[model samples]
Target: MAGAEWESLEQCLEKNLPLADLREVKRILYGKETRELHLPSGAFEAASKGDFELRGYGFEAAEEQQRRPRIVRVGLVQNRTPLPTDTPVVKQVTALHRRIEAITEVAATCGVNIICFQEAWTMPFAFCTRERLPWTEFAESAEDGPTIRFCQELARKHDMVVVSPILERDAEHGDVLWNTAVVISNSGAVLGKTRKNHIPRVGDFNESTYYMEGNLGHPVFQTQFGRIAVNICYGRHHPLNWLMYSINGAEIIFNPSATVGALSESLWPIEARNAAIANHCFTCAINRVGEERFPNEFTSGDGKKAHRDFGYFYGSSYVAAPDGSRTPGLSRNRDGLLVTELDLNLCRQMTGRYKMYARELTEAVKPNYSPNIMKE
Candidate 1:
């Protein structure tokens, strides 16, 4: 009757009650007849007389028939900007506009209902140069900016869900900048945006110089296609971020990122796959391609010192299933869209196989063993 009493039923099932006793509990809970009974003689007599209180039994067969199935198709687009090293920022944005249209056109042709762009896909990752420029002024308000308008139009034109990340200039807050991703619906409506929660300041990755930390908290937007979540760049490194999205009912998550060579590039696919397995959700990791360079820094070295010079963005974009298996990714050295079709049914199938929704006693002990000091 009570929620706590229902929980006791689960505990009793784990203890395996005698058949006669289990049947009596079922009869009391659901007014059903037991198909067969298996019990010791003593327990059988008590159950026959309704003297022994029964536990751990339910009419699961009836509930199974009422459940419905869900299915959806998702896609990811990964590409490189063809901007030469000396191109002006305005021209770079113009070039990106054409590229977005091209990628969206490809996605439409492939019959993808939802599409995503790599992180900061609007402009070349210029923070690596460590130089201030008037062009960085290209950053605009994510909601009404040129980038958002462009994506909104594409989503509407293709009748698809679009996830686009850009350098956002917070118009309301002294025009402070943030690394933000916006989700647009098939109708060209701006759903919401998630700013990069974790900013990296290591080596040549100077994100702090251009953008401040994001203020919009983690959000899972419900769409006609499905419930989806957005995790941008460095946010993927934090496990709790994925957990937040999962608990909020996200069936699909897009990790749009922009990072330099091997080490960080390698972590890109790793994080997305881990999130899918741990949360029983489909994940897509989209990355930028090609080399972007600036003055006072002849950084596009192809050999060993590649990571330091304007970091060559290795474009190995990929998609991971709920079972943690990854699809074929694009070449790390080339620029192209890595397309794949993911069945949302696989998420449900994986959950059933892994029992991710099934409660376990071990979970209660996890807090004691947790390595995060911030949790305490």
Candidate 2:
């Protein structure tokens, strides 16, 4: 904004904004009552008989479809970067390991047919520092990395599909790097993969320094549940990214992201729902929670002093239905699992309140029916 407005905002933050008061307001109004687990950063670890719960918002399918509903219970896991915080290497991976393992076991018992982790989930969002060696060392093989291997076991055990997005180091291909998402099937088979087509240029997200735009275009994978696809983090801003996935016949597209609240909180819930309604597909938006402060300060080239803290990666993960309805978002300041059931036939049948409308429209419009006001 202009100079005066900027000064006013800073003053307001100084005088009126205490972190405690902000949190209290959230607890009363927005933040649902929750019980935090004591394990590292994976407190939102286990899911029992609807412990983390929300009322379903969308409509039910037709009677025929309802009798034999192709309902696939899906889960989205969002968590913070791990212990000995700010330090980006060995400890961080260990923390995520504990977190993912805990959640996977919980989700399987909870009947989640498919589950997805956040983007670059294996490591911190270390690309912000634009440093080498320390962060680059974390990139692992997409084919047989420790991360995918761990997830494969979980998928096989549960008979569920797993989408693990990570920073991939292609050792076989000259150690080149790409932001990739590995899709594993129920039988522990390594299904095909897709990469992040778009990289971010806003603020401290200087990802282009790490890897170029993904070479793998939007590709859909046919799993036992339905046709699925992955739209990695930054691409959520691009509508066509969502379009391409839908165009490729993706019935459910998961957007695994690592964005902060300051950058895109308002836009988060809006864009995904729009994609779902417009494309006639289910959209799952997953983000990492908590802050990962670096040891050193970095400037955003925005005429501001260098700062070590990148704003909080607020996690408000949710699922949107094809009919423009969504469930209540999960916790904003805590790591959590959002599990929701989906009927694949509802996408094809759209048997909600729109049932009669679909039927009427089909009857009203025929192949040769067109505007012929001139009595053609």
Candidate 3:
């Protein structure tokens, strides 16, 4: 048959063409004979077929075959900063810009495509009380915020997707405040924001004091790098939140947090790793480091008298893979950046191997046969 007159694979398969026609179609599509025929007389027949004639078939097959996985480098910046109220707002903004620039430069050198910083990257965790002025001063609109502008410049310069969490000043609605994480694409475009869904109000970490509950739902942003999601500090404790992000098609999720001391610190890795395993997604938890003090009396269990002293902020920034394996994070002792190469293809491989997302197949068990229970 002439190459132009050949039938498509779907047509050939559906029509159940004769062995000879099938061989001809296969040769036309694959550039070689791909079918064998066994005659009813117990005789096998083989025929030499020419090279494939359909360029479109070759293109389709090449596209269907999985491409080699590229290494996606990610960096986590674990740094310490005192409350934004403690320093001049301009000075604080400049300092944050400098720190972000330094980290972006380092990430560029390391070939990191996605860089995530600790929560409240532009300020300190000053929501330890009901007073709204101090925290409100730190909030800025995500579009025109100094921090967002700084991050956009860095992202454009380094060609990296920057995940930055900040106290967003929403000017559209009576200047309402929210704990928001802005995702900036590689080309300096704002993808979307994930608001801190679960606001915590326990002890010294009174997030409700300053910011209201996140109005935005759990959302995953699609970028050139990958499908990414963010869950702020307190939101990390909820499994449903992580699952929601995963269901929304997040391949890698970021958890930027700001909690001090051992109790909250201990729960960090556990929540991140469990989320990764359960949702079949990679999780990066970036926590702040150093000691943050609140000028108020606070007491933990054991009757230890304390005032104006919140325990140390343990900086344990870690990256957990879909297989539940994690890379050790930056030390709690000082400020540093943790950089690692993540193979996102491995997420699909692990999911396939463990059937993590194959609920339809795994849950398709046959019902038990019970003759005694059958109705007469």
Off by over 4 Å in 3: 1-65, 82-85, 294-306, 349-376
Give the TM-score of each candidate.
0.71, 0.78, 0.72
- Top candidate by TM-score: 2
- For residues 61-171, write the lDDT of model 3, one tens digit per residue: 112246666456677777776334466666776787776676567557656789888888887676764455554687888886888888899889989999989888889
For candidate 1, write residues 121-143 as lDDT tens digits: 87777787766674476688888
lDDT of 2 at 147: 87
Q: Work out how many backbone clashes candidate 1 has.
A: 2
lDDT of each: 0.68, 0.77, 0.69
Candidate 1 has a TM-score of 0.71
Full-model lDDT, candidate 1:
0.68
Error of 3 at 266 (Å): 2.2
Stretches of candidate 1 off by over 4 Å are 1-69, 298-308, 348-376
